[model samples]
Target: MKKYNCIWVLLCCLACVGTTSCSDKKSSADEQEKGVTTVLPDTKNEVTTQILKKRTFAHELVSNGKVNARSKADLRFETGEVIARIYVKNGDRVHKGQKLAELDKFRLEQKLSQAEDALLKA
Candidate 1:
């Protein structure tokens, strides 16, 4: 009876070892079949193209007070006459050589006539 008990214990231990080893073998086989590996490929030989081009970007800004430019100046009429007609309002975008406002033509002609008379008298 003692020998039979020892044999039974040995068989139980062998059975547990066999089951664990089979599971480990199955997992290793699965990993091999799936091509799962920890090694990474080298990326040092990759080439990329970068083209240089012009791009335009726009942004909006909000302010409470009046904004002034560093080189801004007030435009005044040389003859000190009232404005006859305004082509643009305040804060309107204008370009170089663009007509913004026009002076009274009659007033300008009168000034020109006065200048001419003065020159004639001189």
Candidate 2:
């Protein structure tokens, strides 16, 4: 234990002494360099011209699309009637202009039925 303590004290003394000596040498060098540092500000004060140019680039692409059957139903509406005929339920396959809903046209079909019945009776 006594040996370890002697080594620790020796290291601390050596570190402090080395650092103090280095700082003294650096301070003397800094004093000598101060004369040259003063001239740097005067040299920087003179303006020097530098040229810069702007550049631009444009890019484009070609595309094509089909032009056919341009008809469209912006707003589709049903008459003020109940859904009498629904050939398809929810989640059913559909194509263009497929019959999806029918109003309460029972009376209209019945009228045709009556006309056919009269023709049979005759």
Best candidate according to lDDT: 1
lDDT of 1 at 84: 88
* Position 103, candidate 2: lDDT: 77
Off by over 4 Å in 2: 1-71, 74-94
Q: What's the TM for model 1?
A: 0.34
* TM-score on alpha carbons, each prediction: 0.34, 0.25
CA RMSD per model (angstroms): 12.6, 16.0
On residues 1-122, what C-alpha lDDT tens digit does candidate 1 reach at each position?
99999999999999999997777467668878799657777766768999988787677897799787556558876777778899988777789989988887897898889999999999
What is the C-alpha lDDT profile of model 2 across 2-91, one tens digit per residue? Answer: 999999999999999999877757777888887675434445466889897676756688789965644544434454556677687644
| Model 2 weakest lDDT span, ten residues long | 70-79
Clashes of each: 0, 0
The deviation in Å at residue 49 for candidate 1 is 42
